[model samples]
Target: MSRKVILTCALTGAGDTTGKSEHVPVTPEQIAADAIAAARAGASVVHVHVRDVATGQGSRDVELYREVVRLVGASDVDPVINLTAGMGGDLVIDPSDPTAQLPGTDLVSGLERLPHVEQLLPEICTIDCGSLNFGEGSQIYVSTPDMLREGAARIKELGVKPEMEIFDTGQLWFANVMVAEGLIAPPPLYQLCMGIPYGAPASPGLLNAMVHLLPEGAQWTSFAIGRDQLRWVAQSVLLGGHVRVGLEDNLYLRKGVKATNAQLVEEAGKIIDSLGDAVATPDEARDILQLDRKAGAA
Candidate 1:
């Protein structure tokens, strides 16, 4: 078993979660501050997704990402920043015309989905492994195989490590395929995203199945949303994987209990320490993720 387990704190996500947790940072400055707090609390990496300042809704603006990168980089804290490249794939197909795009649909190209990552060239970014129905209905997360290939290639060219976000078994399979296709670099990385509606359920059995599907020599981490967050944190570590926790995935420490991003990271660190596994520091995770001083150099 690996003695050091990396802790990743996803600061904010694209989901409509601003109202759910007051601690969820929306603006670039707030996000940067929360990221620094998370890093100081023990997170080796901070996964970020910017939101529109006016509406607190999710956004993919390059300038927003640029500001976030600048603020975080210039801070005293130096955690590896992993931008979310999982945007620009929303497809809310209309029931009337299956062929025609719906009103709420937000479809963008694989290349277009990465302007922020390309601009900032952060230490890491995410490339969702595959597409999946986001929720109970027609809301879909569309990342086609070709799109994934394109995104991965771009991230590679930018010297950004693409954390393969796997929502289910098929996504993991495709991630392995990308490895074979030379779209990604060696020692492939994965992020098991659990409990997102129709995607992989947040259960130990399912998490194990997905974990087992990882490449023989891959680095991986897993997270579950809502109340399942801590469960998956421990589960991932038990499965020889890393752990992720923060306000993005879960808003509360427990029922009727809210938590800050730093509190979440500290809680996860304590859990890992209790399990006889040390929480990896920024330097330790840098070595594990092969991150160098340059953004995204592994």
Candidate 2:
């Protein structure tokens, strides 16, 4: 296609994948190291989600984010930082007692979710565009319309680009709503997340349909979990969109071979190159996303 594809590496997500793969980064230091490695391996952007060092579970501790950002800042490679502001929205309900929230439920207001974004001021941060059943459980990732409006305003005020995470078509609908209301800036960025749970499935037809729904001239990316991760890199790029990969979405590079974040980035880079396309560099990505170099980058 001869297009410049912006590749992102999601270092570690909040999922329970630590035990499944030893390559998943848990501590801030590990996450930072993996991010740098991914950058070196040709990822223009590094998506971060901090985990508790003691348990390998996801955490929203500002200090953890602070440390990760600091480590990345001190590193030689200066990849565009895209921190996850989608935490504190897990609403795990008790099946037996619907009124009671389970122990893992970390529901908080929209403003409460952006503490790290506000404090750290990364180049990009995500906003879960809507609520949905996250998995095969009673838990829902809460991102109501009211909550989105409030969160969008704060993210705008902080001058951080919001990577609108669209799990389903409905979330894409509300994300357009944010754009219509002038909450989101011009050239809104959307991440079409597929194959998580009871949400959008990872299919080319579905990905194409969602891509059609995006606003004209919108900057968008698409990714699928598990085996679909590497495949979607070609799918998304062929459809004229960006791509994301790494341990957060999938662990194994192939059948029985666990992959690190850098390996995934390298694989994606190869995929882009095989198609006669070039991988976008960090500076090119920053310009494409209109990130403020003075404020967002280190």
Q: 156 in model 2: Cα distance from truth in Å?
A: 0.6
Cand. 1 TM to true fold: 0.96
Per-residue lDDT of model 2, residues 152-194, tens digit only: 9999888889999999999999999899999998779999999
Per-candidate TM equals 0.96, 0.98
Please give the distance, in angstroms, between residue 186's alpha carbon in candidate 1 and its true position after superposition: 1.6
Model 2, TM vs. native: 0.98
Report every candidate's CA lDDT.
Answer: 0.87, 0.93
Candidate 1 C-alpha RMSD relative to the actual structure: 1.7
Best by lDDT: 2
Clashing residue pairs in candidate 2 (N, C-alpha, C atoms within 3 angstroms): none
